[model samples]
Target: MSGLNAPISCDLLVRADAVVTQDAERRVLDDAAVAVRDGVVVEVGGRSGMEARYDPGQRLDLSGKMLLPGLVNAHTHLPMTLLRGFADDLPLMEWLEKHIWPVEFQLTEELLAVGARLGCAELIRTGCTAFLNGYLREYVTGQVVADCGLRAVLGEGFFSFPSPMFPSAEDCWKTVRDLDARFADNPRLRTAITPHAAFTVSPDHLAASFELAVELGVPWQIHLAESPSETAMCLEKYGKRPVELLHDSDLLGGRTTLHHCVDVTPDEIAILAETGTNVVHNPASNFKLCSGVAPVQAMLDAGVTVGLGTDGASSNNQLNMFRDMGLAALAGKVRADDASAMNAQAVLDMATLGSAKCLGWPELGRIEAGFPADIIALDLGSPNLMPVFNHVSHAVYAATGMEVCMTMVAGQVLYLYGNFRTMDIQSLKTEAGEAAKWVLAAAGK
Candidate 1:
């Protein structure tokens, strides 16, 4: 973490009239102000008490709004925003084969960086402070995220054949390590092992990814049991289900986070819990791709740590946490047929704390004295926020990304009142458009 600011003074204090601290007590302090020091929250209480106790360097007024911890998108593909509306109305395999894969093959360094910057713009505007992004390559995506002031756990998509970045298996191995070393001392970015999936990554490649993850002390993200076709193929080729194969291969462990456990059995859920592995539920992606509903409630009931994610805008159509929470909550209750299947408060926690845990970040999620001052203010004056009976309930059911008035990460404000503070979106958009033209032509579109 050499490039990280050396944990300096917080140098900022923010006062929001309505502070929604999603702590164990679920305290919502009125006329509250938060004190932040060295990028961490030092105190949260009444404005008078805080002003009297500490002299503030910078004070921000967030009256008529609700302050909560910045959201955590447990999984995403940041650069995939360029392909969002580029491909639609197809199943997972069909979409990938017909549209996504072709464009991915034509993705140049410029295209990758522009797409990532555009995605970063979208995330900052929508109040997402951090995300776990699995990338096809590393150099450009890492640089874009670091330059744009966002945090992502990135990795090379361990593919079996050729890739836009890595042309061969040897190239893949070299790229992962090189990217890991490049970002090893980085503050805002860390590299993880992102094997495409069991369907694409052979056993040898997956084992190598696990070894690399352990070597770098990073976590792993991979698609597991996403479709019945995947499990059936694994059974045909490897004589076992996808989860069973991973378990027998010694890759099913705490350091692994699997995506879309749709075809997994109850026993597989037990294995995830027993091994401390996590699962990411992308309800919108599943529904759009017709991948079937994941037994997420079953996984949670089995003590597995579950987090919410918008797989990618291409699959999800949007990257908004409010909508993600809505879909996540509805997905559970619809499958379980229980009104109390996933509480609104629990879904909010999933977007905040639970997703943080899945990414191995401890200080995020909580609005406590020692947590990072990554916070957001949602303006509750919109028609949706009107007559709010419960703040948390309104946040889950009524709110949308448009209500976010500010987004702060590491005690630094990146977006405020619909305006991004750190980057130039117009220039980024123009550059991305130029690269996308090349992409579309190269992709034979």
Candidate 2:
């Protein structure tokens, strides 16, 4: 449709010094260029080859930066950023029952919006272009994510018991249906059916939620076996382990992702592998909350897909995937009693493609033709990243969250260096600070 010398037009061209494709081959290309059209990657090759074929309307030159797929936070409670550091230094139950739940119960839509905006800022700045979020009133978070241009799976968390948002379980199911219908056409927004946890949500409700998720063709996730106490409670209440209960309820499958399997046994790991159910390992949150380490090595060895997450800012205090990756690798080694238990590449994979798998988004977490243009650029000249022996090693072991200079989702640049292009960071920070103060006074913290 064009003359011989006229190059094909594309929406944008992103050229970088080196690109960690994270593709099937995990190729690291030098002087790489990615051509994007309509938020999809049209082509990826050497800079000259791409330039010669495509004429880009806009160009971003990461001359001294390394590009890679943006990290995916497999599990999180986004609005909990307002609860960060508010209820620390206590046991999990006390922290939740006395402090966290009290504040969550008192959260208004305004406060939730403020916290979601602040959390979205942090996620963008830290190179997370996609995340799975579970919370109450997730439509508010969904609206914020839609405005911010981030890819997210938002779910309204429900339990068998009455809560502030939903008086009955039927109310929660209606909310889920409404969310699915509302976001059905939005490419970047998705709805999920989420029960709060195995211990809190009864078996009948859990099975019903799973059926609803299946009916809607969406994801089903829950907090399962997060602590020994939770496993004990599930056993005492249902005479079955958490995983066993879920299996009995027909809740384990490829579309399901369980967060924080810290207390899972070997048999449970096998069950996960056999069912093809995914698991999200929240290393920092587990350690911070004194929950035991997840047997990630065992899970990975058993062929169970494992992903990485920061849980919630309230527990992990930050949604930085780099920090979580470093901890995952280090803690994996410590847990396995081997220096090379979970390698750099493996942990990086967990944060990228592995997490993408957990979110049921197979096309993301990779840089390739036909993939969405969810990518990030890091300043390669950072002091800690210097003397780069290997790109994956540096990314996993040495790189912190601060090295991210640009974060793009669906070909839209949401963050550039220290600037947020989608939202007003200063205004959101002011509102978030005020909301935190209100939480302090209202929750009696």
Candidate 3:
């Protein structure tokens, strides 16, 4: 053991003007610092206290910045970055069947990886250190995420019908098994069981997938009640609403995340809370597609765990969690017709802690000691962030993703000042540009 007087060695010491600790107490410390060692936060306290106690290999002085835990994207299709702006102003089913699905079917494995890598760049740039992704060719997406040093839970979303990647429903399960095995020992990567949704995936398959997720002790995510049409279709086919179907099937639980619950009723909200099922609110995508706003305030009031997410770039047009955070705050107020609904701090919390809970990562989305050092810095020097009355307010209301100056995952700086430390941004952009052309042509867009 080291002597009492000796300064403990740490990998990095990050000092900022203020640290927003979204802990249970929601403490905001001024002139605070966080000490990281081996990807974990070893200490977090006043800057002078940290400086006096630890010797850091590297020091990051974010004097004009506010530090917060890195944002978590609870639900996203990372590979859909290639489909951004490819389809817009259409309903969810029309958007998917007429444009997104066709284009997705044409995406080669190489293109899928490229799109996922580009999405990772966007995520890192926008201060997201971790994401829960559902997409095709998820192994490729997982490898890209692993190489880029971001934490992710990747799942291959499958339907009752054969997909481009999987020839049969059985084949999809085999792929999930392979993914679970491949990422079993990885700290930064894992796999989820993602049956597409009630509309596209049969009840039997959804149950089987849920069982596999339970057997592997992994999260089970699926798109649910995204639009009115989905609810109508599910009710027409199964004599129950989407959430009710899942609840009846015993699929609603703490480890299950239902994305885009835009059409759920008050009863459904209560059901979600009672079952401990998590929901991801995708405000931007929902609005863009003309899907009614989710009953977020009702859900919150009923004690439902709600996380914020950018559904996919194809529909949302961006993967920036900050954008979604702002939208979630505003949409909730608009939906509830009360300005106090989904306040700035509440939305910010949804993006971080709530999203972490959705992913079943208890140790993530906080800046406390013993937590992973997944943190981000926002440059308070920006004009939009001027005269900051409240850091949390500015973070959720005023600051765009441009204010993010640094994004770190597990003590590793993946993005800083427009520079991606893990991936080649320029080359990836070029390849994505080419891929977009190919996708447009293939989709006859």
Candidate 4:
């Protein structure tokens, strides 16, 4: 054996009756096969072509499923999965002030870890292979990601409030720096500078975050123009729109990752596209919060690298990218009055290749030859996916998370036959249940 001490041997060859490679051509092959070794796709073609290729130690038969690239969550608060459905049916500001903030105030490091394990499990269960996460707890995120074997860009939420981990802004900076150093060598993890948002962070702090991101060569992820109230607040406080404030602060660039441009203008969209600033659209969260739908078609038309994200469970109530894609198409159709505004194939790309670009990962999205063997297969026999006339349309409009039958990331099978391979589901459930009780108790409910 080699000295690398790898987690698992992924000499896996996965075959399916229907394989839809979300590649340059949007190709889908019937009676297709894929060869994976050492965490990357080596071959993808007809079954005969793959049979002529190098043999594998294992094979997954997915004859009745439609295989595609693993879904990517471009933005989310993973640890908030425990808080799913805890608070709902309110506007953004009131919801934050009355419920989310108060509950967050009592979260402990252990609780965050417990919640992250549960979130990872949920993501795996629903075929989400990679996700970007931001939370008030940093070390916990790093540890859980490393242990759970998921791709993540971890960022500690920083604000003016006295958080549990940091007392001052300096303390928060120091903590994030330490986290960055700790995960510097981890391949499955990376670090980002998250300032929460414009309304929560001071101008000086926002500038510092961008500067630090530049210095450290990490992406800066921020919430911007998420709601009209946020826009109003930015104008009142900084005499400019949220995007303008960010652009003025020199924070809009290739290394900048913005969540929700729900209320941005055409000019701001142009600036973002020109600067190569990546934007992630959370259609579900925006709709739930009554935040106006983002001008996604306009941004895409302007050549912006856009992706899909579920936001967080507290707001989204789920971390399913398929659900997010369905919502995106629904919202896009209603807002643009074009039923084809965001179609199934397009939303599928947004979850795979588009989401990868937003996350600064160029090589981890598609199922093409030489791409990572990150893939998922959904059962087509289900009622939602039955009588498949158009595979793409069926996936975007008819499919649901409950139909996911397999999830593979980095050539490793994370979930199959309804069993998680890497994470301990029972332990996570037990720990998460206890932690949720504590969080609720601390919230005095």
- Clashing residue pairs in all predictions, respectively, total 3, 0, 0, 0
Q: Give the clashing residue pairs of candidate 2, or none.
A: none
Tell me the spans in candidate 2 whose CA falls farther than 4 Å from its real position: 2-5
Please name the candidate that would achieve the greatest lDDT relative to the true structure.
2
For residues 370-417, write the lDDT of model 3, one tens digit per residue: 999999999999999998779999989998898999999999999888
TM-score on alpha carbons, each prediction? 0.94, 0.98, 0.98, 0.94
Tell me which of candidates 1 and 2 scores higher on lDDT.
2
Runs in model 4 lying further than 4 Å from the true structure: 1-10
- Clash number for candidate 4: 0
* Models ranked on lDDT: 2, 3, 4, 1
Off by over 4 Å in 3: none
Worst 10-residue lDDT window for candidate 4 reads 1-10
Instruction: Tell me the lDDT of model 4 at 93.
Output: 94
Q: How high a TM-score does candidate 1 get?
A: 0.94
